[model samples]
Target: MKSILTMLGIAAALLAAWSARAAIYDAIQFGEPGSEKSHGLESDDSEVIRGGLDEPARILLPRAPASWQGGSVKFKLRVNPNRQNYVTLKLWGGDVNENLLILHADGRQVGYRSRGDIGLLDYGSPEPAVPGRFYYVTLPLPMSATYRRERVEFEIVSTGRIWEPGRTFEQYQKKMLTPSRGLYRFYVHDHSYFKPPAEDRQGARPEPVLPPQQPESFEALKERVNRELDRLLGPDGRFTNQMQLLMAAEAAGLEWSRACRNPEAVRRIVAGLDNCYLRWREDPSLASDDRSAVYPAWTGFGPAAEAVRLLHKDLGPYLDEELRGPDGQPVRRRKAWADMLEAGVRHLAASRSRHPKQSMIVDLNLYRNNRGLRLLDPSKGLPPEVVLGCLYESVGLEPWSGPLDGKGKPVLKSGGSDRLFTAKRLPKEFGYDGNDGELPALAAAIYQATRPEPGKPGDERILGVLREMIRARSFFRYPALNLAHNPVMRLETVIGWRDMQFPGDVTYVQRPESGASVLQAAAAVLEPYSTGIVQQMFGERQFFPSLDRQMEDREFRTTFGLLHVPEHYRLLTAQPASSSRLPMSEGQPDFVFSDEESGVLAVKYGSEILYASLYWRAPHAVNFLARIHHVTPVLERLATVRQEVEFQPSGRIFVRPGWTNSGVGAGGLNYPDNVRSIHAGETLPIARLPKTAGTGQENPLAGRGDFYKLLYGPYLFAMNASSREFTFTTPKNIVYKRLPDGGEIAGGTVLKVAPMSTVVLRRAR
Candidate 1:
């Protein structure tokens, strides 16, 4: 047989280099490489190796602590393939407790690529050849794995076994776990990751959250700044890395200093800042090719700029203070500040790959770092990529490539029913990234980057994004209970009625809590709903980290991009906070909001408030392909059982006659179906769920209760979170009433809701 590896390298030589150098030019950080064991010694078993017609052999990758960061494994093996009995491979591992390749990263939360998408040794497959002689193959490990220690694992399917036609690997593997009789052996060798760039990557300190926005008395401002100043001078404070506290000190510290008639406090702040500045500038770690550089740059720079601004008058002597950089360049402290700021900015700009086309890594540190740099070099501009940090574009909510058109007006989807407040981000009318926090974080960066100008807009386009985002997410708020008024319907991005499936693990219908942290602290635009989103996010969040870590694995950094967090809006501008918890209310003069693009209409008619999604948001790659939007994936505590079901929200239901999808396919493998089969009225029972995959009940989560419950929390408060409006039924209905002016029917379970809506009733006396 012709060989693919004859010109590449011999097996002996390939296996000899058990560890190779890092693959940095690839641009992704594949952690340090090289395996602990340096030998490719074959197994010493005396018996002849064999294979079972049903089960395959398992080969554990050599163990190395912290070394397997989304890399590949190269090994040598001796095998032969033919028309009938050829070898195939099935690689699998935990994406939670260990490393696993994460695919579909471009959409919502990326789907961890399930077992092996690697190689096959079938008739026309690429298996390094020599008939019965040995050859080499490389298996790349996944990034989002969940297993504890075994880090990486793979299998050998040489018996030419195939899961039943149309059956998935999930079902095939579930029914075939025992080691096969064909005990093949892999001569151990190299396990390594792609090389990472020299610039270190790390998270900035958590986005700072500030005190609420309430007009403060000079005395109050003085007291707060003075207290923060005290902490700054205290022994424990300097090491604490408290950026928020530091900014608070600046917000009113200057005034407080003047009020006390003491330049001493101001001087001390200057002194403290100078100390931090020099430490960061000279600390080789901050400027090195190592990982800590971005960390200090972001957390260190922003606060430093604010301090410098605050102490301008008092800095005559300090400005002349000289310092040496890590490179041994000596300059006045002011110039030194520019050098430090630029160094950090240049590094991040050089290293970061943040963009709409690639990853959703709106690193808060990068923005804070650049803001600090621009704060110094006023002529320099904020990175255009900063738009990603402010208005994120995910699988569903693809807001903008840039936030404006050539005319400099905000780019938004038309069809919002508001004049001033109705710029919609669902221009494409798609799903939402479950992270929820990213776009807000990016928008928050705009505030972090700009100084508050009276009538001037700082980076108008970016500011437009910030305003539009707050309006977009908060629009889903149903004021009375502060819960998600988001209108959603699944299409091809979701499961089909009978046999169709989308490409992603999640369709961008993000968690209601994605906007929670931002909601926790109110902002003017987040109004009416700032309190609402916060309540809604937290209310739903209580049900999870409910799924096991692996159930929905994603990039560690991607999680931080959700816009739900920004240090504090008050720090940016003094807009009053919606501090009051969402109060229950019937319509006062009729409150109404309509999103034509998203097909959502929210209306509060006195006591009867109704939220409805009249159509699918927009095009999803999944739905676009399937050419339908009838059936979606759903989970609810139904009139019968609790499980994830194929929902025809328009009232079409597919009822399977079984209690379990425990075993069905020829090899008993559970594959996803890509045919129109279920919708609103039908039940795609848990038993109907594939026997494998995240939505499947294959994992050890029995004690975790139902996975569907997390998504279908018709909570204790009569909140119906599912897609269908269910009768809040009771063993018997607990009745309630309204005053003579009350609008709707008295309620308990009698109240009805559209998907993700809520109803509150005052019980009758």
Candidate 2:
């Protein structure tokens, strides 16, 4: 019995030892050394008195044990007169990674800091120190697998000055110099042994949840587009409501007229213009008011003037001969149009007179001329000198001001609008106000008006504006992922006028590259067409090849006009060198040509060629064959060899094949001269082999009926066959008959054709 009792006592002792191992560490209270349960010595500078307002104090802690791994360390601190100060507690130990965690006074986790491969710790939010309040802070000192037990020392510090918003840096420095008393009490406790209040744990709030987005359908997209178009183009359209909207509406109308050549579209165009004119007439203030006297007249006059000019220039031919005026008297369309134009010019002249020292035509004024609309005559209203001065002032050039200095540069003027145009400042200062289409349209209009006039002094300033406008279009920075609207407006304006001027005369400030915006690429390729620019476009399209199709087809149909020409021209890169190609670098022959007979459109840059089929194809669905040339220095070779179809209202159907090396550089169908309508049963071979290609490229026909057909009207039909092996052959059952005046013929025999070729069937008078 004695032996058993001794064994039991031994077991009891072991249990007690284990319990002590799990026991919580003793708490350390700040006071005189040995006054309380102080486990370690205090810093020499720290005062050891019970509790009173005093300076910052520090306390050291006994070495932590290795068995404390996976557990946390915690402490409590109290500050008198809770002031907003940065309260920091730093703990360091022998050869251990430094890890810091911050928490709000309310115990909400905010952030964490780790150093030297130490793991992350949840640092709660840093809350302002409240006077006379105690905060419980928990530090999760995670021990690495390689951690060795060692002594640790921690110090508490609280120091800061009062700060307020809107204080200058100097004031902040001065305020920081003024000190405030910082009194704090520090206490340490074993983290695992103590449990914080439940409310403290619940202080953190989760981030707010967001609702899911509703998916849009094709019909919904179509409906939305229609609604927006109606809102923008209707008789009560918002175009007349504001100057910006008015300009955008005008550009949209112009595009609509070009894309959809239907009666309803033309009528809408005319109606929109009529509304603008009527609105101007109703508001006599727009015509008679002194624009310079208005607060923002400097910005307002240019757009107002541009609106009047476009209304007259674009709407004059389409308007009805006569319309009832406000007094109920019949007014001729031309008379009303001229009246509005005169009023706008008079307003500009008056504004110029009011701001003699200031340039009436600022960069903003030019931006307001989006379509590059020119004055009907520079001789009328504002003279060339005043207009030129304004133009020069807009670009920071005083060509007429004084003779050239030592460097042949115009002498700088101290007081003038010319100071406003700097390379660094101009881009941010000017350009489209927003994604609105007005500014580009306005710029285009100004270019059209001020295009270089030969032998005219000060006309070069117009080119300066043109160059600046291009720079703005290409290089103006935009917010990330944001797009500029109607980027091609200026390009279209320049292309429309290219034929009237010398090829080398017009120069762009920047050469467009592969990474440019889609609209930018469209504009660049057509600007004195280069195969390189077109090839670059093909390369760039890889990034957002379908973005245009998705956004443009659904939301902004205005892009239709901008893309129409580029889409119709198909480039065939598969052909040999003789077919034409464009170089990747600069130095190329700049030429743009449309061969109606061959149905081939081409642009050349040096030895490289960018050519496409002129026949119409669905712009959205066309595909190109991509070939990889190099990987280290990336290069691509894209090719397209497809057939397309177009229909005419006069009972003619055109089928054109893409250009290939086997045929003439360009080839298409030939029509019979002065021939009346063909009989419904008549089949005629329309494609004639060029003398150059001769009979060498001829092949037998498969005579297949597989073809894609489009109907524009009851009489007009178009069909395209994709098979290269198929050929056209006259059917024996159908009869060929001719009719007078090109009347519609019912039956026509299938025409014979070579493999991989196109032909057009038409009844012409």
Q: Quick one: best lDDT, which candidate?
A: 1
**Any runs in candidate 1 off by more than 4 Å, and if so which?**
1-226, 234-245, 253-262, 281-300, 309-317, 324-330, 351-423, 426-430, 433-435, 438-445, 452-467, 479-585, 588-765
> What total of clashing residue pairs does each candidate reach?
73, 45
lDDT agreement with native, every candidate: 0.30, 0.29
Q: Highest TM-score, which number?
A: 1
Per-model TM-score, in order, reads 0.36, 0.31
Worst 10 residues of 2 by lDDT: 623-632
| Model 2, global lDDT | 0.29
lDDT of 2 by residue, 371-451 (tens): 222343332343344455555554445422332232223344523332433332121111111122113233333343453
lDDT of 2 at 188: 26
Q: lDDT score, residue 348, model 2?
A: 42
